[model samples]
Target: MRYWLYKSEPATWSWDQQKEKGAAGEEWTGVRNYQARNFMREMSVGDRGFFYHSNEGKEIVGIVEVVKEAHPDSTADDAKWECVDIKAVMDVPKPVSLEQVKAEPKLKDMVLVNNSRLSVQPVTEAEFAYVCELAGVDPEKAMKG
Candidate 1:
């Protein structure tokens, strides 16, 4: 499965709120950016992503799994907008802060490091794995749930 990252302002949507959604998950709506919307369209059920707290924490606090594929965004009136449903999979034992990511030589090419403005962006397998390692999580075990 592909890896991705989803950023949300903590005051608007925190990691705790996402975990409360349970297995049924919640629609990742309100995205208006065409590039971000397109990234969601490329996602599939079972794909994993980093649940990042933007603005406030500026960190990767947990992991999430795509429970539903791309579908019409319920919060939007435009037919061109779409999103996926994702559920919290596991918490990062040690939150990986943006500063940590930027400092890491191995993660210099990460989208989160280079294009911090994108709310939804793709994550390469290597980048995903390294971040998981940095967060003190076992990538294999975290994905099993």
Candidate 2:
């Protein structure tokens, strides 16, 4: 499974709000960027993502699993836009802040560090594993949960 990252403002969609959606998950809609939408199209069910709180906490607070593949975004008026459904998997034991990520040599090449504006972006397996390690989570076990 591929790894990804999803960013959201805490006031708009916090980690707690995502967890409240439960197993049914929630459509990751309202993404207007073509590149971000394309990334959603590439996702498949069971792919894991880091739920990062942007603007406020600026931290990887939790994990999410894609429950549905790309589909017409319910919130979008244009047919060109699409999104995936993701459910909360588990919380990051130790929230990994953006500052911490940037300071870590291993994550220096991460897309998040380079392109912080992208709402949805790809994450390398090595970066994902290392971040999980920093967050005190086992990547393998987190996926199983």
How large is the C-alpha RMSD of every model relative to the true structure?
Answer: 1.0, 1.0
Candidate 1 colliding pairs: none
Q: Write the per-residue lDDT of candidate 2 for residues 37-134, one digit (tens) a residue.
A: 99999998999999999999999999999999999999988899999999999999999999999999999999999999999999998899999999
lDDT of 1 by residue, 26-80 (tens): 9998899999999999998999999999999899999999999999999998999
lDDT of each: 0.94, 0.94
Q: Each prediction's TM-score against the native?
A: 0.97, 0.97
Off by over 4 Å in 1: none
What TM-score quantifies how close candidate 1 is to the native fold?
0.97
